[model samples]
Target: MRNVVLFSFILLFVLLIFCANRTTKNESSSLQSLYHHAKVTSHPGYEHIWPNIEFGWEIIVGTLIGVFGASFGSVGGVGGGGIFVPMLILIIGFDAKSATAISKCMVTGAAISTVFFNLKLRHPTLDIPMIDYDLVLLNQPVIILGISIGVVLSVVFADWMITVLLIIIFIVTSVKAFIKGLDTWKKETIVKEEFVKHLESTATSSEDVEYKYLPSCPDDEPQKKINQGTILSNIQWKKFGLLCFVWIAVLLLQIAKNYTATCSIKYWLLTLLQIPVTVGVSMYQAIGLYQGKKITVSKQDHGTHWPLHLLIVSLSCALLAGILGGLLGVGSGFVMGPLFIEFGIAPQVASATATLGMTFTASISVAQYFLLNRFPVPYALYLTIVATIAAYIGQKIIDRLVNIFQRASLIIFVLSFTILVSAIALGGVGISHMIEKIQRNEYMGFEDLCY
Candidate 1:
């Protein structure tokens, strides 16, 4: 086991190095092309916020954000970019386009590192239902349509809409958070009948069940217990249907909202965060389906329909996530996470699987960005190298810190959302000033002059 783990770590490290080198090369080449073709007056926007935000500071903030995002994602079975992207755009002066691209790139590095760290630590079983080939086959057209539409929109309208949409998302998310907090406080003070009824419903769903199976062997020998048919028949088909419908509706709405938001904000960072948050919330609902279930099946039925169903659900979610990630430059794990939970996957397994899916989706997005010449080479190279190295280091630190907080998962998510809201409220360092500073380096001493 130790040898296997060590080998895995070494392999991941090597892969990281290779990916970093390749990314660096591609980014450098892209940068040169951008510089040559870009209008001399257009000046790449790197220097506008350079003086106000030091490289060290950016690295520190980026690393912390990655760590927080990774830790939350690891525990909640979702990607943390929902928080990271908004924070970067709002707090850092990155335009919507640059922020989304960078957020996806950063999330890819962090997710890969987090998965490696968790696997090395021998995290418990993550049992995602196998992808349903049938569902994938059935939904391929819808998924394709969504992806094609998203990609076309991304190319045509992503630039103008991302910022404005981000501001709106920020306001809405902030209001939601503040209201949730208030509700929590209010609930503590008064236990209304509705609240009590809701709690009772939740508790009843979480209650354990008792069952007994009849002996299968003949009386000639000692009787052996056989799985009861009653148990299988008792499967809550209605509840399952309800759960599936709720999650499906949530997933569709989230995708629609995300597409709408991306059309407006065009900032990849905020978009990255929004999509994953939607996925995570969806996963939370899925987990409820398996909260208190005991299934003892006969060997014959043990592997029958469940795996197929799981596979279909997982694939449907994963494909949707990948398409969105590819088109919008965010991790698709948001969609995958909830689907895994709904399909009866364990939390840790769901998280690991979701991260794995995000890794692929983010990679595709990065490749597409490169092919489309959406990234400037020097900036891409610098940011990718920095993010990758930092993510590796951050993962180690996050693993160590994970033990300190009992509810670290929930805390990390709340904090991530809070940071995002605050950043969005800040107006991404103001649009006019951002354009001016990028066009001319006049803002270099503005901070010091103001002070």
Candidate 2:
């Protein structure tokens, strides 16, 4: 079965590449004369969708797509930006860059909703909040800094390059997530058997059982004297404050960067200022984790001190995730979701914590996009509200499902499936646009960030 699944993914990837190549060839042959000099309509980009607030078929269709994407994306911690960008372009009639900007808005909405839902919950077995505040502190600052770098780099890389890169990265990540889900599923099965046997032994033998191996069983354990207020009160306020500090510092620097000339001394200075704020916070957390002062409660207990290499590795993954967010116009949660699982964090905690961090970076991305005038206010607002509501609903349903099945692998599978769907959707749209440009004999090279 595993071999078959691997082969299936390989086949699907090959099929997408084949279609892209064939689509390019067919466009060349078919539209060579039909659209001489191509004169494709120069869409007024955001203005095309902005001024007209019509409740037409397109808006209706877009709302449906946004809701589904948000529901699943929120559950998977991917913020559905991968799905949102393509829907905005194909159905909603926004240009690619505009679609990317508005996609960030939807992601921000979903991430915010998911984070709110997660905050009210606790770790499956540990006496801590499900949202790992330490993990967020260690990763969020760098994720924000990485995003700053990616957003600028986004302009320099051509659209087709991003599309192709998105396809490759999403597919690879999807496969990894799926495989991790399978392993987690098997582990859950073993845990289930042990739990059942322990129950039976206690019923018949009456011998004192040590409960030595029931680590993952408390997933469905009912909360004791729990409410929204306590959930909020129990959070590590110091870490949360540091996270907000990095967020505000980066936001202010970005806002300042916009006022300066692109690539000017002041602009570069403002950009460089972001690094110290982010690095200082992450390094502080890393040192704490190393000296056993702070813990990634999702991955550690009170006495669990992390190795230096693992600390270095976490920082590296944080950097990669940050870069991925900037390149993909999505939250870094998509990467963190699976990475947390590999670090021995439960899938439930992984999804929650990743989304919490996503809330910060995605909202920041939305602010930056807005500052760039990349999205229409009306469209962004409407779609954001839609995503927000959908995310809340999704969280409720998924939480119930996890409790009922006692299988946390469900979230991992959702993460993988969403990324896979994004790969196909984004790849198709990108290839379609690339073909049209090829037929039009337009430039297909890197773009000027300053321009």
Query: Which window of 10 residues has the lowest lDDT sum in candidate 2?
Result: 33-42
Model 1, residue 156: what's the lDDT? 48
Please write out the lDDT profile of model 2 over residues 160-255, one tens digit for every residue.
Answer: 898888888898999999999999889878987886787786665423443322222334233322312355665788888888888888888888
For model 2 the TM-score comes to: 0.84
lDDT of 1 by residue, 294-395 (tens): 221211142233344543464455555545544544444544544443443333344555554455445545655554455555445544544454444544
Per-candidate TM-scores read: 0.44, 0.84
Evaluated at residue 82, the lDDT of candidate 1 is: 60
Candidate 1, superposed: residue stretches over 4 Å from native? 1-80, 83-92, 121-149, 155-304, 307-316, 319-328, 371-373, 389-451
For each candidate, the alpha-carbon lDDT, in order, equals 0.43, 0.77
